[model samples]
Each structure stands twice: as C-alpha cells, then as structure tokens.
Target: MTSNGTSIPVTADGIPRPGGAGSLAGRTVSRIGYGAMQLERLRTDRAAAVALVRRAVELGVDHFDTAQFYGDGFVNEVLREALAATRDAVVVTKVGATPDPGGPLPLRLAQRPEELRASVEDNLRSLGTDRLAVVNLRRADTGPGLRAEGDQVVGLDDQLAVLTALRDQGSIGAIGLSSVTADGLRRALPAGIVCVQNSYSLVSRDDEDLLRLCTDEGIAWVPYFPLGGAFPGMPKVSDEPAVHAAAREIGGTPAQVGLAWLLHHAPNVLLIPGTADAGHLADNLAAGGLAPDGEGLAALDAVPSRSADDVRLG
Candidate 1:
C-alpha cells in the first residue's frame, strides 16, 4: 500500500516501477532520492530508522541527503548503521550549521574554513565514510536565516577553498550549494558547484530562475521541501485543490502529483523528499513513474507562489 492507502501497481513483469534516474556530479542517481531530515525528528526507535534507510535502498533509491546538524548527528548515525553495507548508496551531506548547545532549537552557522573542516570531519566520522559523495555548503546569509545586505557572503571564498582542498584530498567527491541565490551560485560556480539544493515547490517558485541557471549549466537542482514544509501557516502542496483534482484524475495521491510535477518541471531536478514512514517513501518513489498530462501540468503551474522566507529553514 502507498501513503494514500492505495495498492501499489506493478508492471507486467511483476517489477515495481522504479523512480527515474538523473545525473548528479557525473554520478547517475534515481531522481526520487531519500532525505534524512525527517529522520532527525522521528520519535521512533533506531531500528525503525535503520529499516527505513534499508527499505529505500531496496526500492532502488541511490541518493540520500543528510546533514550533521540534523538531530545533532543522530540522523547521520542512523544512516551509518543502515547503509554500512550498501556500497551503492550516494550520501550527500552539508556543512555551515551546528546545533546551538545552549538552545533547544537554534542552529549556529559555522562557515569559517576551520569550522567547516571540523564539520566535514564530524560528518565523515558520524557517517562512517572516508569520502562523502557530495558536500553542499549551506549559505547562512540566504534563505530563512540571517539575511545578507549583499549578494555575496563574507568568507564564501575561504569556505569554498576548504571544500576544494577536501575534494583534492579525496575527502569528498563533489561540491554543492544550498539555500543560495542565483548570484550566490555565480560566485560559487567558479569553485566548482555540481548541484544546487534550494527550497522549491508548486507553491514556492522563488528559485525558478536559479533552477533555469542550473539547467543551463548542467548542474543538478535538488529541491528541499519539494512538498512544502509542514510548518504552521505554510502552504501544503498536497492540500492544493489543483493537486487534489489531478490526483483523482491520475488515481494517485496529492503528494504523488506534486512530486510528479517537479520531475516534469525539469530534467536536472533530483528529488530527495524525506519521510520516516515506509508507506510515504513508497508513495514518493512511485511519483517518479507518473507522467502528468498537459492539463495536470497547467493546474500545477497555476498554483500561487509563496514568499521564499515562508518556506526557507534556518
């Protein structure tokens, strides 16, 4: 059964339809990858978390997005245990943020070269890997955190220097950027940006231009909050009337329709929708197989756009 409580359909060969594949930093990965953010918030036991990761791999999901800041390394620990033997998995993690020890829910930006190096070491230690598949430098000045007066942030070059050094040292495979603007991308591209992870969905198209830029440059656009974050007052893609109507028409769930729209929206898009529930994972992966018609695409495109601040995370 899927997240919407529908029976999963298989092809005539009895094989479950796999998610489509896309290239990220020269590596081919399933467009429908798993995100580890939800694992940080899951109240379930460790076994359950590990099981979910294994299940995702079993379902042919190769790309997994995670960060050391998530659950103060709890999520990466879970991934370490789960993916220990899964050599084919592509783990993408980020730097530039750490949980503030004094606060219950505040993150401190650690963008300095020294801090970034330490964070990278922590991620490697926690995930039990020598080299990460991709390391996205989370721009603290942009997105939902502190706003920068200028397009460029201080110490960005130094941070990229650290990442480039790591890549040269074989500690990481590819470099990326997160929560960055088009100008930010322009600055970081010279340092070798292979992907851009930003907030984007049917209701949040603030990164539309950046997405195009990524496409033009052959960089993968990995969208966070692809279904819109579940924070209060934030728009939910599944709740959109157009999504619901399209779901009905296609015999799928609203979430499935939203994800389908994203895949259809761009070839460079690589989805990493996070979910702790097995059922939801199945639904998200199945969405990659959906081919939305022109009508469905039109409806999805017509959804109102929300402010970038509304969907960005600190």
Candidate 2:
C-alpha cells in the first residue's frame, strides 16, 4: 500500500523507494523496512504500538520484520490486527529457538526437524497468514550455561534441510538468515538465500565486511539497530571535528544524523530501526528524506573502527 498519499517512486537509478522492491510472496516491500520487535512491548502500551506500526505503513514502510519469539506470540497478533487489510505488504518472521522465561536473553534451540515444523505452524497461527513471505533461521550466541550441549543448536546442514523441505511444501516464499556470521553467510549464500539480517549501524561497523560481501553477492543486508540497538553509541566519526560540529550545528538529534549516514553509505543496505514511541518512529522515517553531502559522508566514513573486543553481538 502507498503511504502518505504518495506513490512509491522509482528512482532515476531505477531502484524503487519503499514498496518498490520486488515481490516477496506477491507482496511488494520497501527496501527500507520496519522491524517490528517493538510490537512485543504492546502488552504494556497496545494503542501506541498499533498506532506506530500503522503510521509506519502510512510513512512508506511496506516491509516489516518480526519473529515468533518476539512476544511469545503477541507481536504477531498486533501485526495481524494492524496490517491484515493492507494489499501490498511483506511480513517476515524467524524460527530456531524458543524464548525462555527470562527473555531473548537465552535461546533454547527448538529446531530439530520436527520442532522446526511445529514452530512454522505456530508462526502461521500467530501471524494469521497461510504462507510466510520470508522465514529466517534465527541464530544467537549461546550463553555460558547453554553452551555445554552446543549440538542442541541446529547445525547449518540441519537447518538448511528443514528450510528446503518447507520450501518444497510452499510454506514460505523465501528464506533468510538472522544473526549469522561471515562464514555462515558464505555457506548459506549458495543456497539461494535472499537476505541476511545482521546487527549493523554507524556506531557498530562490525558487519562492514559482511555488508560488502552481501553487496557483491547481490543479497539484501537488512540492518537492525541503525542508531543504537538498546543503549546509544558514540558519534560515527569519533575523531572528526567537522562531523561533531555539524551535528551540534544542525540542532538535530545525533540519531537523525547517524541514520542519514547509513542511507548514504550503501545501496544494498536496508535499515529496520525499531521504536515504540511514535515521535521516535517519525524521526527515524524522516531520516530517509535527509541528504547529507560529501563532507558529511566522508566524515562518517572517517570514523575509526572499534576494537574487536569492544564489539558485542547480540
């Protein structure tokens, strides 16, 4: 569905903006999509979450990323109620681990082939859809306590087998991977993988190499936490005086500047910045319209990379 009463534009370079990308299960999604993890907080503020999601659609966000583990089923319910009537929208979800009582803190792999099948059923029920647009095999680092039986986590071959089986059955339109490393992506890319959901942003450039690899391979790299995942990070160009001065001069939030930097950085990058607050959502969507010049872009690129030890992957 076209948002803000503006038709989805086909850029001069011919790439479409929001809702211009090719179909994912007959749903034309915007490359710059919305990640729906914030919907999990709906239990505390249902109206706000629903409004933010609907408003995101109104702001040209036609693609939404969610997962069965988001709210133990709540987020999907919100998406179902909010966007069910929309004609052209893509809803993506994942399967791999079941959330323990604590939260996404510890993921217990429920991806044995049978369990994977069961999770697909649960996703379908929660999402209120017959076929999922894209289903990712979600992976996360095993905590200290959960690492003993590491084999419990589904291996690449096993996960691929399950996905291929489901694909043959027409349960999902496309397959993707979430939280995978460079090695993992290399292994999966040959299997017709269409997308890779990794934690990437201006402050956290840990995925830079992976991002380049995906761009070279013609795969979509959907980045989560463009400004900051939970806690905010420092400026993009740590030592660049000009970028810092410009950030202050614009009177705009540092976040708006950071997001604008990402949009200008790469063509294959698709950002899914999640927020429960309507104001923050509006600010994020507005970042798409900002055009930072060569000096600004160079200043951001000049930012020094963080030490390997300092980069933390969730």
Candidate 3:
C-alpha cells in the first residue's frame, strides 16, 4: 500500500523488511526500529535488556528510540553498553521531560534553556557519546504544569536557539520535535525539524492530520505506540475483536497484525515497538515481514479510533 501517493517498499518475497532505509537529519536508519522504553520496566535482568539491544542490532535495526527520563537514565546506559562496538546505530533521545523529583509516575517538563542543556548533558554522560545522534524537543503542553495561562507557551524559537547552539558546538547532530501539533510544527519548521515523534496507532488516530502533515513535509513520522498497548484509558489492540480476527486469519499474533498494518499504512511511518524478552523482540521485528491481505487490512482499519484524551505519555 502507498501512503500519500508514496510507494511502500517490499522485499522480493512481498514481505516488508524495514520498508527501505530512510534518513533523519542525514543519518540513515531502518524504517522498522527498536524503542528502548520497555527496558525501563522489564522485570528481566539488565543483562537481558543489553542482550535485546544487541539482538536488535543483529536484526538490522539501527534506529533506537530512547530518553534520558526512561529508567532514570538506565535505558541510555544499556544502549551505550550494547551499541558501543556498533557505532553506526542512530540513537534518538528526547529532552523536555524528567521524572519529578517528588515521585516516579509524574513527569515534569524541563524545557528551560539551561535545563535543556543540562538534559542534553545528562544524555551525553549516560549514553557515553560525545555528540547525540538526534535530540527531540518534547512539548510541555502534553504534560503537567507547563501550560500557559492562555496561549503563550514557551517559544519554539527559544528552544531551537538552545538546540541550534548545541548543534553548532557539536553536542547534537540533529534536532526534532515530539508530541507537537500541526501549529507547533509550523512554528518549529523554520528551525529545521527532521522528524516528529507522536502518539499514533490503529486505535489512537487523533494524530492523523499531523501524520499527513509530516508526510507532506518529508519529515519522518515515528509513531511511539504502534501496538496501542498500554495508555492510561485507552484499549489495547489485542482487546479489539477485529484485530484478533484479522490476526487469526493472517496466522500471526494481534501485535504482529497491528504492526503489519502500520508497515503497509504509510511509506513515511517508522515503527519503534519496544520489548524486553528476546523472543518477543524477535516476534515484533518479524512483523516487518508480514503483509496482511486486503481483507485483513480492511479489518484492521475498521478498528475504531480512540479519542485524544485517552492518550497520556508515560
């Protein structure tokens, strides 16, 4: 399937494997990438997380999504240890949110110019890298206590000013945005956004307009929750009857079917499904090789879209 008139690439066997390579700020990465958020919560040992990262690298997954806030900086350390020998991997981490010193569940936005610098420095120290591959300026409006009284949120230009200065100083190679709306993108585009990470899935499609905008602008749309797994009030993809039915027909797990739909849904849609177990990681990665039939695709598409309020970033 083509997205916004762009052809979806497939392998010779008609399966999709990473959907051809795409570039983010001149750094090439696989379309199907690994997200490291799961490492923060996995009951498995830290060694298992490290092994999973290495296994992902062996599976041709060069794009890794991580954040300094994840695992209170432990996830980045795992990436540092796993990818130390593999220098070509493109590790994308986010700033603008930190675990509230008061507690673990609530995340506080840290977008102050100096705070942004500190966050980048923390990521640098944790990831064991002199310069970050990509740093996303995550929006604060989506979180707690950062909203402006009326419409006067922190200026995107101000944030970009700090990021650009760091880029000039070789602390960051590229800058992107996270959880931003269409208007936010318009305001930040002049600052040169190479990608946009947002909440998008079959059930949570409120960001469809933003996805279209990203597609039109040639920016990579990296959906964080591709499987619609666990959000505060939203339903998981596995809970949907259509998803299960389609999975049964397609001879794969519900998660695989959901990911396959994403692979076929758009040419610019990059996936970052995270997992801790090696077997589950292998299964998730193999979703790239599953192509749903037209009937199955329609069934997957028929799943109802959840409201925007159901989305709460952890």
**Highest TM-score model number:** 1
Once all C-alphas are superposed, what RMSD does model 1 give against the true structure?
4.4
* Candidate 2 regions with alpha-carbon error over 4 angstroms: 1-28, 103-111, 141-149, 229-244, 249-251, 307-314
For model 1, which pairs clash?
A: none
Which pairs in model 3 have colliding backbones?
none
> What's the CA error at residue 24 for candidate 2, in Å?
6.5
User: How many clashes in each candidate?
Assistant: 0, 1, 0
lDDT of 2 by residue, 37-91 (tens): 8777667877777777888777777778888877788888888888876656778
Give TM per candidate. 0.89, 0.83, 0.87
Candidate 3 clash total? 0
Model 3 CA deviation exceeding 4 Å by range: 1-19, 42-44, 101-106, 142-153, 310-314
Better of 2 and 3 by TM-score: 3
- lDDT (0 to 1) per candidate: 0.81, 0.68, 0.78
Worst 10 residues of 3 by lDDT: 143-152
